[model samples]
Target: MSDHERKQLEDFLAAIEPNIAGYNYSTFSYLAQKKGNVFELAQGRLVLQGVPATSESKHFESPNLKVGFLHLHELKTSVKQFIESLLTGKLLTPHGELRFAPEKDRSHSIYFNPFHAEGVPFQNRQAFQYRQMQLHIRGDRRERLDSLSLDWELKAGPIPFEGVQELCAEFGVGQIDGDSSTVEIVAFSVAAIGGESSVTGTKAKLVINLVDGLEREKASIGYRLIERNAVVKRGILSGDALTWENATNFQRGVAELEVTGGAVLHCVASHGGRAQHHYWVADPATAQNPFRAIHQAFDKNLDVLQELVTKAQTKGANARDLEIAVAWLLWMLGFSTTHIGGTPKTSDAPDLIAATPFGHLVVVECTTGILKEDSKLSHLFQRAEKIRQTLISCGNQHLRVLPVIVTTKTRDEVKSELDQAHKNGALVATIEDFPQLINRTLLVPNAERLYTEAEENLKRLQNPSPFDVSGTKTNLLQ
Candidate 1:
């Protein structure tokens, strides 16, 4: 692992150290033939027997007993799973309780189901049993705080035959037959504890195989974190009802939910199916930001694009390189066969010509220099107008002309000129906003809607006058 990855692992280990200490665990580290840096956890000396008479029994002098083994490559996922198993094992211990209490400090406790014989309501009496449990978590900030607690219940029963069939859908995992008495229904709350700012009252559920008897198939665990307050008012009723005019509170609540939800998903992925794990953040307000989604979609390629943009700025940008990069960006935004126009200082043609899928032609004039001076502004306007005329004369009335000036910085003078140009007909967009625009365009699956939206925005910019006469006598009477 790299230094950064090792640090991440160390931090994670430290975060869960209290829980590990509660279980009296220690690590056994050694080198393996196939795996590097083999780390295993245990509580006491581990010994292996039952070998052939000719071979002597092997014994480990380490007092720590082995409870889990982890591979470095799967460090995060494995650690998460190990922690879950530790929590579950502690709850199922004979004492039915686990406490994390230090000298001269507040104590936290987890209480398991002291009464496991109780049957679930409407369950097959002979087939299943229910057990209620609770967990109390304590922490110290600036002052002593109330213990954060979570209550939960579980139902254990025999695994069904269809469960085996469904397990085949995921890659890996051997086939199995016959019912395994290992299914469980887990309902618990993931308490958000720390300071007053911490979000509380989040519930989650998991239904899966509980027994570690699956030969090659890990447990099929599924989980979801539920936040009751994460809701927006659709509309108000005629009577006294709630209405959602803004999403500020909802957004804030969802952000908290993401933290708790991400943890639960991480644990599930660790124990269930790491490759198939998928978590959906269902915040419509955040989803509307196409730029964020686009960044996520191109996360792997963003560094390369950023590097190119930086290189262009650091080394005086070559016109050809900038044009080619812009062309590539257009293509990434779903444009097909982008054509770069006019050699630098040679032709008066537009810099780019492309068409939307719906036949809406786009003519673009690209530049990399700041338009701070009147001469530069005038030259840009003339070029854009010329391009607009050329496009109109082509007889394709569906064409849309966009003059784009790319620059590293925007001064007040340049911005003033660009704003005026935009009001007239052109668009002034920074190089940084290009990714956002591209993502927004791609988000609109319908070509006609995209074209219409762009045209409407431009028209709105061009017309600065208000629709209503605010100072008129008619307006005053109304």
Candidate 2:
């Protein structure tokens, strides 16, 4: 960083030190590994290497490919199987090494249904040329944030092109067509998405890695961190609801930390007001409750939002500028993970979930335009109350669902609505007063200020320089 950049960062840190401390935090990103290799945890130690493909798939790479990933829908499907196994008193694997994909050779990118007996590795380039399905993941999403490109093919017989189509659609790819080469074919269309779950106590990330036609390797890394426990990562949601399975807990935590590191690089972080004094980042041992990290981050967003509203030199801004500036704090809270609870029909989706350590859910929302002291702020309370009631009527009200009414107005005015709501029984919180979050104490220096000032400067930067007749000219948009 240049002197100017360094100075700016220092200024940012100095500005938002207060709000972070209350959130009670200590820790930073904690993930590591290499690409094109396989990783599994046996005893708190990471097993990283290339998973050899089945003999039939080995020639091209591996005959069969197995990738251990987290999928909410898939989990639901496995829920019944899990219950059946338990009831039958089936022998349980001593080590909770859950297999998510087909067992295949390391090089084989193609994935087949694991329901049937396994096959042998490939012996010819034909498999490489004819693809069955190529899995493009947020590159090493568990440990590395960078997205990657991987392809798998079928050579033993005519490719099941339809199954390939089905898989392609899942990644937003249109279809495939055989090229001049007999074995090689190409698919069209692809996209990706990513975020972090600060609310889901499980904190398992969702990796969506496709966008438009171009694919950015580490597409989207997301997790739901909604737990209140000594070791936040240890309370992950797996095996069953209301319970956490010690399923490669250590390895999974490491991968999640790795993925978060990669994803946060694309975002930013910061806090302010009485909350920074106790924030921890260097040594995690002295950190606050890890489970509730995301919730506290969400609360701190109000502080950042207040700062942004105050920093606004002008009374008005471009619509996009206003939206981007206010939303900055919400996203910074690391609300990347998408939470799934309701069935396919009649279920509502919360903008955020404040979860308990044992998979309990809390709903929170942040809305713009609630100027401090504005009478409309009262309406926010009504909205929150209604949301709470809706959840209650659905029988989920038994859980502590804290709905918040967030705005970017100054504290003097916001405090009124907050006070009124507090008196009326709303779980009111400000982004400025959230507790320290262990997972994001030092997410990025001066993140709140950096993101705020960056957006402001970015807006003004649109003013173009004079046509450069004598100096180097550049077009950065492309």
Candidate 3:
């Protein structure tokens, strides 16, 4: 970092220190709105609209006030890009320099602290608003005041993989493990989604490899200390390629750690003047065998989502696995699905056929690669049309048959071909939509609702926008 930039960061940190000090001020709220053009990073409650930026207090009072700002130019590029920059340690803030962390620093106060305890009064501490808290009935007041600090935790919900992937590609994380081709960090033996009951002593173990020929001598690595799915701590790991084990309890409290699980180990490794951000996730342990039945696998295994996400990200290499996982997910979403591609007789047919009880049906095709061939869309559309005709002939004219293509590719990766998919009357579900699909399965679990959602998404994709280049959604629309 340049001296000017360093000074600016230090000044900003100093200015915000009072706002972040004390127990009451240990955490802040972050929100991105206006479709990512505007983001609020406030030490107190963040209001989206009508929050005026005040000169006297920097932060707002109650009804409407926010305390952070980014240049229009900075946000115009993209919100995800901005976040990726921050995660990769490119963006400097009050916390520490993201790229560097002090060795053995369990308190990652350096990573990012919207909260700082420099000038804020000890008496002004915000009670019941901390990630990790400890209270002593009797202690030296001066000593207690002198020892105030905050641990790193994510106030925001889980971050999507797309953001992490983009960061790695942009900064270029060098070789780890044996693969130098791209970001290849993996988490083994941990549940990808959920852990066992809180009483059980099943601990989650994570193994990270920093083998020979690694471009960087040291990398900043950290993990989300989780209780259930909430992050209790975000601490730095001290060694290279070490096996880290989860604590059975949070600071020896009643609340068990890693139970009902969600955990992530993040690393920012630099090489060739670029730093890459990689994540390894583990869900908590479950009693159900993941290899049993499709439904059992989805029900008992906490790692189902991660497994599916991995398959989608890897795509072609594990194309068949992706197909089966999607099919299984559709089934869990209350769809009566037929795995057509699984059988030799229907190998040439659409990959899967999913139908709602109310006669809404989707002809599904799974792909992990490009979808540019005219013949491919034509074929999917034709098959769907044939199915529609067949239903009409069978006196089910009210039935709906929608051709759908599911791919692990990102929306930008398939943007150019979206018009073709729309032209062919096909609903193209990219990697962006997969998570929502799974979330809907958990949230709604109604086939009819998902069918409606698919229909709506298709319409939205096919429709023309009402805004021009200078309009509100021109650049901010996700």
Candidate number achieving the greatest TM-score relative to the actual structure:
3
lDDT of 1 by residue, 321-435 (tens): 5555556555545455355465656555556665667655555544455644324445556766676677678876556655545443323224455556565565554444443
Q: Which ranking of candidates, highest TM-score first? A: 3, 1, 2
Q: What stretches of model 1 exceed 4 Å from their correct place?
A: 1-299, 342-346, 372-394, 411-413, 438-447, 465-478
| Candidate 3 local lDDT, 259-357, one digit each (tens) | 332332222222222222233333323322122234554455426644665655652455666688778777767788888877778767878899997
Judged by lDDT against the true structure, how good is candidate 2? Answer: 0.27
Each prediction's RMSD over C-alphas, in Å, is: 24.3, 24.9, 21.4
Q: Rank by lDDT, descending?
A: 3, 1, 2
Ranked by lDDT, the better of candidates 1 and 3 is 3
Worst 10 residues of 2 by lDDT: 41-50
Q: Write down the TM-score of every candidate.
A: 0.34, 0.24, 0.41
**Per-residue lDDT over 36-100 for candidate 2, one digit per residue giving the tens place of the 0 to 100 score:** 44322110101111111121111011223221222212233232243233223221222123222
Scanning candidate 3 in windows of ten residues, the lowest lDDT window is 136-145
Q: List the residue pairs that clash in candidate 1.
A: 42-64, 42-65, 42-66, 43-64, 43-65, 44-63, 44-64, 44-65
